[model samples]
Target: MRLLALEASQNSTYYISRYQQVEEFGADLCVLNGEGTEGTWPEDRYRIVGSKHIDDIIAAARAWHAQQPFDGVLTFSEASVTAVAAVAEALGLPTIGFEAARTSRNKLLMRQAHEKGGAAHPDYRFVPELEDALRAGEEWGYPLVLKPTLGAASNFVFRIDSPDEMRERFPQAVDGIKDMAWFTMEADGLDLGPHGLIVESFLDGREFLIEALAWDDEVYLGSIVDRVTVEGDTFDDDVHHAPTSLTPDEVAAVHDVVRTGAWAQGVRRSALHAEVRFHQGRPYLLEIAVRPGGGGLDHMARVSAGYSPIEAVMNVARGVRPEVDHYTPTGVHTAAMCLISRAGRIQEITVPEEVSGSSQLFFFKVTAGPGDVIKRPPHGNNILGFLGATGTSFEDAMSTATELAAQIRVEFTD
Candidate 1:
């Protein structure tokens, strides 16, 4: 059966390529998110139909649906989740509904549903202006997180330590910074349903990721990744370890939370990625990106834990149950860490092995070059490259990955 994958992620690059490497599935890019992509994909196995508008994406999906009767649709993106759901529903396909997708996009709605569903979470308020957020903050307290109610990649998220900071950031609230599509800005700028930015009581503690693939009305969790991020980089969850740092009880606890969260949000069988933070022993929701975590997260799961997220995703898209073996770790540990390139031109690499080395050693997937727009303290899609490796332990896995990251030797040639 033909599968239409609605992915706008650069993360899917590795997954698509790995699928081709393993000769798994024949897939096509049903739509291009106009996200400009994190990087380019390989030239074979799939076709690209680039269109950023929802009507165009819907049109494309409909055309494909008439030709081959696509079995189902899959997505790893929030920007297009609603669109995909609508398309799939019209085609009489099985996937999460537009209602669930809409609820997932709004932080206010998510919190309310979680609360109504008896899921544990912090208090949050949504407001149209900075004043309401501040008012919510006054009620919540200092050290509250001010972020977009319907945002990904942490575009306008911040923390306020005092009333001064709140006033300083919000000041007067302006919209449309780059003429980046009125619809796009509207979606990012306004929370029509919840009606504004969210002021959530900050729940600080160790955060972990729970990625699951739902099929046959059952949810199968991949890995529980231990997450860390760059000092100010809130977009990407920087550091990741497979097999999770949680004990058995904690894992089970998180599983219940995830299942409840999905059910509460109206998410049916589909691939779901949830970002959760734990305080003292309770799991508090941070933010949920409808897609898989970027930065080669699926790749790291395979390299570190022997699981193929791409295959599982394909199963859901094709209405087939994935053939997944229970993972058994070898003595060797593995990891794939991201490498940030300083703003400069591509001059040379200190380690030549990256250009000509076996997979057992290390791997580099470089995306930036000199003369490119460089920013200090990388976050969000501004990443320069990736570093991956296998070692003997978790610490060793991280260390080796970092060492490989250092060897990446990128000189931004400007």
Candidate 2:
């Protein structure tokens, strides 16, 4: 299959490895980006649109399609989902459709769709300003989640446990979103839905992440990982373990909720990254992204559940039904976390040979380097990268990952 991936966000370099993996999965891959560093992809297979405007992107893609027709269009970046959908429609390729893509990427639209479809979800209100946020907080009570409608990687997501907290964070989120990388990198002139903050009643229970597929009337949970991060005021730190510790009945419950959410969001056929958290013993849909879960989730899924989300992406992009099943474990235990550090410019990061070459290590990638500024909480949720480890059990894996992570030193300069 010949696939053309769209990434107008200018963050295309981060997914070079994924593009290579797609090629390794037996498909010819070409990338079209709005802006990207040279040498990120093979010159012959990569092109820059040189513009984030939808018209310019479509024109470039159309010209490329004429030279050699692409079988499908796809993207792993959240910021490019809508653009990919547009290109796919323009080129007469398989797609989840523009409306579905838009709703899935915008939290407010997703919530409205879910509500209309009667899917279980948190109470939410779009807060376009501080006054609206204060009003929402007054109505929802304390401990509400404040987040951007078009956010990824947990930027500016906060938990407001009191009026003072809400007052303090409201402006930060409002101003911070104006310059957020995810929002800024989006294609120009696209109807991106509401560009504001949403206050959602917090889900006070265990959370789980799934790499799923929705085909026709059926939605398959290909891989399920538990979000085992400890409770906190801000939703920055991410820690996960797989296969999930949920009972069979609970797993089934999650699947049902996710199915409702997919159909609700108008996602009939697509690769999904669904998040559900329990509230009062019932699962509530957090989100159903049109892409797979981020970080080392792909690795966790492959090692623990024997499911390949990347392969699913490839199959689904061409209007083919990916081979997926209900969540089942391969008995491999693994733990992964986002490596966090103090806010400053990174001078150096040192990883010992023992940690780098450990048998228990399954995945390790450092995203930050010299001169890269790391922003922690309140400012931004920047990270060093991701690290995942495998062992006989969850505890063993967590221990190995945490211990090794501590040994890797990071020097920061203000």
Which number leads on lDDT? Answer: 2
Model 1 lDDT per residue over 172-278, tens place = 22242122121252212222355346677877777887666655455666766777554441344456666576777877777777777777777666666778888
> Could you estimate the TM-score for every candidate?
0.81, 0.98
Cα lDDT tens digits for candidate 2, 1-414: 999988986673578778888999999999999876777788999998778899899999999999999999989899999999999999999999999999999999999999999899999999877888888878778889999999999899999998899899989888889999999888997999989999999999999999999999899999999999986888864689998999999999999999999999999999999999999999999999999887888888999998999989999999998888888899999999899888999989999999889888888888888998888778888898889999999999999999989998998786
lDDT of 1: 0.60
> Lowest summed lDDT over 10 consecutive residues: which window, candidate 1?
173-182
Candidate 1 displacement at residue 329 in angstroms: 6.2
* Cα lDDT listed for each candidate: 0.60, 0.90
lDDT, model 2: 0.90
Best by TM-score: 2
TM-score of 2: 0.98
